[model samples]
Target chain A: MPVYSEKVMEHFQNPRNVGEIENADGIGELGNPTCGDIMKIYIKVKDDKIDDIKFKTFGCGAAIATSSMVTELVKGKTLKEAERVSNEVVAEALDGLPPVKMHCSNLAADALHLAVEDYKARKAGKGPIGRVETPEHDENEHDLLEHA
Target chain B: MKIINFDHFAATKMRPEVREAMEPFFMQEYGNPQSIHTLADEPREALNKARLQAAELLNAAANEVIFTGSGSESNNLAIKGTAFARMDKGKHIIVSKIEHFSVLNAVKALAKLGFEVSEIPVDKYGSVDPMDVKNALRKDTILVSITHASNEIGTIQDIKEISKIVHENSGAYMHTDANTSCGFISTDVKELGIDMLSAAPHRFYGPKGTGLFYLKKGIRIMPLIDGGIQEFGRRAGTENVPAVAGAGVACELAKKELKDRTAHLLPIQKDIVSGVLGSLDEVYLNGHPEKRLPNNLNFVVKYIEGESMLMWLNNNGIMVASGSACTSKILKSSHVLSAIGVDPALAQGSLLISLGEDNSLEDAAYFVKELPGVVNKLREMSPLYEEVKKKNKV
Candidate 1:
């Protein structure tokens, strides 16, 4: 198994606010399945505050735990407060993620920030963007091994 | 919580009888096998006995078996050693794409040394066609190496057929990385008609750090290491006495009990394949259903990645392995899966459960019982699963 912190394992095993809120105010999805990680965030806003928040993730342990942690960190806070959350902050909140996994999997806060942006866009009568772009995986950057 | 090991391909617990055979070498009969002192008698005899035992397992002459540090070392010796020895005659090599890194990288290094290489591809079930090997052979193809079985996907290759093609068509020698199948399946060099084969004792419930390399008699190869004459001067190192002794016993036991072990494992392999695939949607087996090792089972569960599933199963007292990028040290998914045409997205979800003699039918049932919960939990949190469910609903 990957070397995950206790906090990461805890959040991965029993993630908070899993699943989606039907007819959510704003939904933000980040990453893609092809890159081996995809995270979607759903938010309910009331008077500039995040009334309810949940997430669904398709990824490794770090990705799921980071998504769960970002939800717990930003729920009930205003959009301004939630915008402060970043990949680094989510990783810090969960003790830390593996360095190799941090860049790819620790992006829940980016999804949350997109949700906040999506909500603001609707408030201005623009549009609800479905997904934020993530970088394409450069296959040449890694050395491949058969096992861990 | 009871710890159940399903990762037998990686390592196995040392059997009691093998340990008993090794005890005298650790402290009692500790002497250099190469020494001329009176104390060397027992250690030299022990080394000879180990060689005989290992040779018996492969149906090769005792003088043909050379003890090495590990299976990887043995493969390196077989590939690079053969290449360097025959570079005067030819500079071309042929290998299957699904071979272990040792064989693949050794050939790659040979490519750097001006040797040409052709990687034969596998079919959807990860079986290498003998005709591909026949076509890949050229006048300068001095070596052809393939895996006897894949540890990740569990597909066995037709080595004998391929070996025949190599010998009949060219002067190339045939080699196989039989590390995974040596104990679990039939790996007789004569039956396989291969000139060289590599095996490890650790995968067969013996000690680690000991490996056996069978070089057919009269075949010459350059030595990877240079030192005082040992292993017929082909491999140069002081023999690991205890490990060799344990490995010998392990090989002896494997030969004696191969039939019964296969019988016990075949039913469990079938049950797990049926049980997991039957209950789970979007899950598929990775290897040939009937042409695989008796103890090997691999699957790809869609939507969720394998490392998360491994964590959940490990938390629930079941230990398994995966070929996901997250689980790999280099963060790249299995090349074997890629070679077999599995989608990169689905290959991230690969899970391998390799059984051993110690694992009972109940353990297989327990894995079948526990795996669904783990897959369900991960799928529930998966955004892709939501999309899949939506697609199904619509």
Candidate 2:
């Protein structure tokens, strides 16, 4: 079921821009530990263009590859154009991801969208829109974590 | 590609001797063991011989051994068969938390039928306490199934002690899933005092489609498959003759070579354990230090997911298995790791390296040499690692 494309493997083996930008204009952190993946996207904005971008991800091959692919996709593009990029586009860029992985780890574009949102919120003098509010850990969720 | 298989638990190459034994049954002696024709005579004799060979490996009588389609099938027969046969007496069952899906899911299905199931938790090293089994036993308990050893973490259970407790405390039939321990360890049914034992021939270099179930004499079990007079009217199906013949040869060879194989693997296991753990930081072994299978090694490497590590190692010509959500069909980390209280996040980074007779010191050393580079490469991209690094600076 997990026959990853050659492009996914290549990007996973040698990810590009894999580091956290210490002082970024906007940041988007998607996913949580319980889901077995976490992505933190950092961006540098210059005149509404995503001038420099980097990412740090804790996930599987698809997550890392998608993260790398999204960064490659939106670099040097204006915020509006970057927002047009979607998970399907990122998945298409890497040839394709496994269907199961596409839902779980192909979240790089959402993270980029969140980063652009965070950029907009900051431009209006609001603090960094905090990380996505993951569900409160419940017994059923714990069981899923333990036995799913 | 010269692939070095560190994933023996997932699949094993068939031994040449076992393959040779199966050759005649495939084409030359291809006849139904139940047929009354002359062509059936050889197949019928071969089937009986295979049963005897399998029984001898477990020190049980040939008549008590029932061959099934696979280890999971054997487990289903043992668990559900016993449960259904004794449901009039009791509908309660007990199983360890770390049992294979075959045992766990079978009991789960029973739960929907108004049966009660108690899951005994394991220790941090994945050992189920005998007292927990004793406590879980009820007046209405019909069966108790526990694993002899975990295929994931490699921890061997105290089956003898647990079996003794189950016998003295309750009238429930005792079953042990010995799929991971059958060929690698001594599984004397009388010595362990177990009523039934389930094992997979594929795990020990036989063909994949055959399973071995040992039912103690005088125990009543309802058949999972209701059909003809095959398996003495117990498990009804056309016998997989070629695989059964191969399984017999594999069992015979396992009994003959157990000691030598253990001796050969011990030093290599020790070398790999020390080599990997000593060279890496924030890496930990997953099973009992001394009470683990000689051929199994499992570890959780921090800050990197397991699939990435597996892919990198495969690229370097080594094949291994992982318990990470990414590798699992259900997209959750292994329940065995969770049973031992491993963090779900850390459980996503499990690496399971299982050795076999074909593995050598060079292969173990090669794995040790190549692992750190892969871990480093993955860690460099992990945000979790960045968090740890930032915390350490303070």
Candidate 3:
């Protein structure tokens, strides 16, 4: 049997929104270097709806296919509607991945959820990550001060 | 469709002549070799001839060769049987990190059986260093198992040097799995100072269900199979007479054609490898350039998955395999790749294309012609490639 469904190969060969959004309102990056799978999901929100969504994935065919399918499934949907998209829904949209590639489906769903959480955090003015704080110049930067 | 098969590491088609040699034993003279009957006499003679042929190929005595069910069974017999028999002397065993799954899993099983298993590390080219084997050896170490050549990267080990260390430095029995190396390289067991050698007949165009297990004279190993006396009471069962006869003929042919086959296979490998590496950027060969087998070509193409590349290759009528045979559908990278310290991401992109008696320069050309477009397609869709480009721009 073929390891992938025809739809999975289709999405893999022609993945949609396959680049980074320069100013994405919400971004989610998840990876496990041990398994060599990494994915980033980006969303542009407008009026509590996902106006635009894209992804960048560095993984197997299943990962790229799921990323493409997840983007197609979530675009123009309300936040609540987008949040309803599960790994099963994404995998089903792609005619189902091999049981071995089910983890790739998890990568798709988790990345989207992380992005949504990032969006919620930004809207609450408590952005959780992606900030580089300016370092204060100190003479004792290389040396530890004596603690009391 | 014309299919170009480069998965010889996985299996090879049985030679027609060898099949013809075996055809009679399947039914006409089919009998248990051990039974004392008219039907049994032909099978017994066939078994003896098969053993002799295998012995001649390895330059060993016919008595030393024991036919087994398959290559993996031979390995299991060599490692586990040896360890179990010699447990009174020691409980420790040493094996190379880049051994085939049979050896690795056998070692793992020994570990659970309370044996101390030390997996010696390999070099960057996936070749086991003799000195590393020496260092891993201890007074209690009973057996040391290493592959003659890697099935993944095809790096031929210096078994003569390593086995010398095993025999001289300690009382350990030295074993090598020569399944992939049998026809591709010289596997004179006596010359290599190897105590035990395992080889599968199908690897050299023989039928499946047959393999060779050679143990040095006077070396005792406990039987993995406990039944009626067969294979000198080492392996016990009704032997598959037809397959065994085929293996004998195949071994004889492999020995006769060893030099010719190597001469024919090397150019085909070099042609494909040079074509792939010349045209592709961010790609590198997987094993030692000079120390590899004649027909093995392994390369890693960065920023894409091997499964994806395999799908595209299959579509183009090219048959090859990735490092990892998917285990339970998880795309785990090969242990051989991990042992060589390849980046996990790049290891996921590994490809192994092993040539056999049938491959040619034309097949290599076809592969080179079709590969670039497939690689390009995958890379264009890869975010890793985009990141690499952006980084290079900076």
* Highest-scoring model, TM-score: 2
- Just chain B of model 2: what TM-score? 0.99
Model 1, residue B214: distance off in Å is 0.7
Query: Candidate 1: which stretches are off by over 4 Å?
Result: A124-126, A136-148
**Tens-place lDDT digits, model 3, residues B174-249:** 9999998986688899899999999998988999988889999989899999998888889888888999999999
Q: Given candidate 1, what's the lDDT at residue A97? A: 72
Model 3 alpha-carbon drift over 4 Å, by segment? A128-148, B324-331
Q: Candidate 1, residue B58: CA error in Å?
A: 0.5
Q: Give TM per candidate.
A: 0.95, 0.96, 0.91
Alpha carbon lDDT of each predicted model: 0.90, 0.91, 0.84
Using DockQ as the measure, the top candidate is 1
Report the alpha-carbon TM-score of model 1 versus the true structure.
0.95
- The candidate that wins on lDDT is 2
Tens digit per residue, CA lDDT, model 2, B1-394: 6789999988999999999999998889999999999999988998999999999999999999999999999999998999889999999999989999999999999999999999999999999999999988999998999999998999999999999999999999999999999899999999999999999999999999999999999999999999999999998989999999999999999889889989988888999999999999999999999999999988999888988889999999999999988788567788999999999889989999999988999988999999999999889888889889989999
Interface RMSD of each: 1.6, 3.4, 10.7
Docking class of 1: medium
- Chain A alone, TM-score for each of the models? 0.91, 0.88, 0.83
User: How much of the real interface does each model capture, measured as fnat?
Assistant: 0.63, 0.56, 0.44
- Cα misplacement distance, residue B358 of candidate 3 (Å): 1.8
